[model samples]
Target chain A: MALFSSLTPVFIAIICVLIGVILKKTNGEKEKRETKSKPLSRPWVDEDLKDGTDHHLEEEDVDEEWQGLDENVAHVPFFAERYSEGEMIKRSQMFYELLNKRRSVRFLSDEPVPREVIDNVIRTAGTSPSGAHTEPWTFVVVQDPYLKHKIREIVEEEEEINYKKRMGDRWVNDLKRLRTNWIKEYLDTAPYLILIFKQVYGWLPNGKKKTHYYNEISVSIACGILLAALQNAGLYTVTSTPLNCGPQLRVLLQRPANEKLLLLLPVGYPKKEATVPALTRKPLEDIMVVM
Target chain B: MALFSSLTPVFIAIICVLIGVILKKTNGEKEKRETKSKPLSRPWVDEDLKDGTDHHLEEEDVDEEWQGLDENVAHVPFFAERYSEGEMIKRSQMFYELLNKRRSVRFLSDEPVPREVIDNVIRTAGTSPSGAHTEPWTFVVVQDPYLKHKIREIVEEEEEINYKKRMGDRWVNDLKRLRTNWIKEYLDTAPYLILIFKQVYGWLPNGKKKTHYYNEISVSIACGILLAALQNAGLYTVTSTPLNCGPQLRVLLQRPANEKLLLLLPVGYPKKEATVPALTRKPLEDIMVVM
Candidate 1:
């Protein structure tokens, strides 16, 4: 009789757990259906609201002025061409392969490239999105032999100081595998040296200055695109930042004081025997978190 | 006779100018032919080199140790499939057009997004190139409702203070056209809030710090890729940087002190009636220089 009573309680417990599992699965399906039913909803819209209340009007007075401001601005109709899912995957994979081949080459050839090619690459880079559309960047192309030689000398001088003094022992040690030194023959050897300058603020016609927001972040994004464009053109380049050469470079390039040197790119073909250190990228699991 | 002599000198000068023009045209053609004949030259090989000296050996002493260093490190063979030039252009153009369609939306839908979609987009973002391939970035995905609500409240508090006190009058005026306010409902409404934290330095197994290079520039590139990836996935997102929310967010998220907040992205579908500001990008000529 005791064994029957205990067994009866265990059977009841199992039945309750099964019922709970079934209910949970049903709720999950219901939630998914609800999500699909309304992929996009605007509760703030007056026509969609069940209650006869316009919530937008309840905002502050400053926000009311914003609507008037929007009216003053002009907008053009825009429609993007949609691609099939398969097409998107193909394009993404192709781009990934293209970018994968890009490497920073130190040994650059002196082979002359057409000026039009450089112009097109820079234009492609300018297509990068910027903060508030400020486009606070300037791409200066240097091909003059004298100017290239001068830049090379100045960069070497600064880099020598950096290698010996500015950079800590550990920092220098980390760069050992890169096999780089104070000597930068590529600066003069490369046919083109594109100097990217970040504009801190804009100069108005009235001689007043307008502030640029997220200038550093915006310029960095543009530089990344610039590197990609150069590589896409089958050109090899290195992102070289010669410490303390900014002041001298500004004077040599005759740029305004408002412009700061952001990055220096020596673009050309890679030498036949050019080599890079073997480095492995972190696996995707180490860099991402999924919830 | 004197007038005839003067006319003869002028005619000779005009003839010389014509000859110079003809010579320049011929030189341009010859240069183009030369470039085409040897598009990619392997001069480092012995056949092409006039001198037997290999310039690679002349580098600094530390560089000699690099080949030894390569032996210690592991390498995986990488070969990306090549594409024709015409196909490359087509793909680049398609990508450019797709990215052009991406707009920063203020009104976001609260629609539920598939977890797998977010995972794929983040993985795409991780493929960005970093300085020395350090890949010093961490992506934090925030989806919990309570946590989202808390982030929204804190971001709003900081933005309100910024609009009133921190931002100068000129900066505020510039933002008037966008019709943005202190309120940030999208932070809570969006299904995912991706917080990108930059690792300034890494902690080794031995409890030593390993310095990261170009951390700011590296993170910015990753953020750009993240934006492109999200847009590619048919999702709308805005890069939101609400200053002064870093400290509180770190505490809430429980991230280490070394990780600095670089960018905050709220990803979701745009509201059905969502509208964006009409802003034009700078013309190509204004941002690029050719010499």
Candidate 2:
């Protein structure tokens, strides 16, 4: 009890210090000019930060009844204005509903999904944030019979090797429920294959290979978005990272040396006789803690 | 046209070849005694190699039957006999809806989020799939006042330094849209601060650190699940890396050195008057391509 009481003051001091520190880091850079006053008022009070007028969300609030205010962030455009209150709620809710229906489709139907819809869904994925905003990802849509065949050939070859030599007995044992094997009929059966690539670093306009910030994290987030958007757009997706096709896929796609193959997707409708593994989700109590 | 027509047969042959190879590998290890076919008559012929069992998810059936004939998968315990149609639709739809609302929130409200809620969410995050099933993340929940303050201070100091010195002009300029400065008040205003540590590897059952499989990717996916769950539970969150609090956080928390700070999250209810930056999503056409 005594030890705990003594540590109380130190703890309080730490919390105050942290709060001050974060405000300084997140706000200080924005108000470099005002060293004398609190940075908070400078941006929040400035009419410009309330989303000064440039956006395409179809909202009608940009007409200025007032005059000139300083643009606090010269580089950053005003937070995308033009989104209305009702629209925001609607869009947010709609997105949630759409995302709810997504599934990993292992069994696929031969029914064709429209290319335009797929393209639109992908467009949504591309909007995700990336390291340095490099947006370093390539979406390859494979529909050609020969190309998919080659991909299947490559993937199956590697999988067979992994099952036999690379993976241990324990791993093979662990995979007993996944129902996966080298024969990926979906690779050919699906109407489309979206191969994703991640670029570690990127080429600049001046021919320099600029370093990317948090490349792996950025790519992972974007990949998640891509998967989600496909589901939202009424498509089934399974994220597959084949063990040994890194070299073969790179060469086959004629991709740049800096880019690496991350996943192979067979996107389409589920077969009439499709079924998913009867997996039970952990109850909210097991998964969540409410304070 | 003639070249394309001739290639179709070649493609079909290639798929067959892949199938042959995969079957060869799978059967190579199957025990001879187990290779005998079942004599019982069934409607489903099941032409393909049965890599795993299917507890059929029939829409007509309300309860999913567990036959208990299959192998085990982490976080999946059902050896289901049959899945109901409603179950499949519910699962698929749930995935879709949850996925769409998923967003990385940087802007946050200071209103306190319950510790129990955060804990529950972290537990849920733990349910995600890990590479080789080696769970490689540690969750450190810090609610102590002084510790929170200290974290804020250190984070701000590093961020300020990053903006002024390390980050180039272009990089800083690019971040302009975010209007992010070093000040992170949400760290304090929020009720709970959850620090996620990525364990590179940990001691095995025998006291040796075991090798982790694609540990980074696995942990990230878990984070994704946690984020989804938190949102579903009606809580707001802000994900941050802050600046240089990584080492300090580990020290402050007295964690094993193998763990490195991955993300610092401030969870709570959105402030009553709080507003998120208005951002626009890219149109659907820009992202997807179906060949």
Clashing residue pairs in all predictions, respectively, total 0, 61
lDDT of 2 by residue, A88-113 (tens): 34444444445434445577667776
> Distance from true position, residue A125, model 2, in Å?
2.4
For all candidates in order, the CA lDDT equals: 0.64, 0.54
Off by over 4 Å in 1: A1-71, A75-94, A111-117, A231-233, B1-95, B111-117, B231-234
lDDT of 1 by residue, B119-166 (tens): 666665666666555687888899999999998998899789777866
TM-score of chain B of each: 0.73, 0.66
Candidate 2's residue-wise lDDT over B1-291, tens digit each? Answer: 656544545555555555555554444443231222220111011211110111111111212222222465433222112224344344445544444443445555554544545555665566554544456677677777788888888888878877776554555655555566778887777667777766654454444434444455556556555555555556556666554557776787787666667767776666555554444444444333334
Q: Where is model 2 more than 4 Å wrong at Cα?
A: A1-105, A168-170, A230-235, A269-291, B1-107, B113-144, B160-181, B199-211, B224-238, B242-244, B254-258, B268-290
The DockQ scores of all candidates, in the order shown, are 0.07, 0.05
Q: Against the true structure, whose lDDT is highest?
A: 1
- The RMSD of every model to the true structure, in order and in angstroms, is 32.2, 26.5
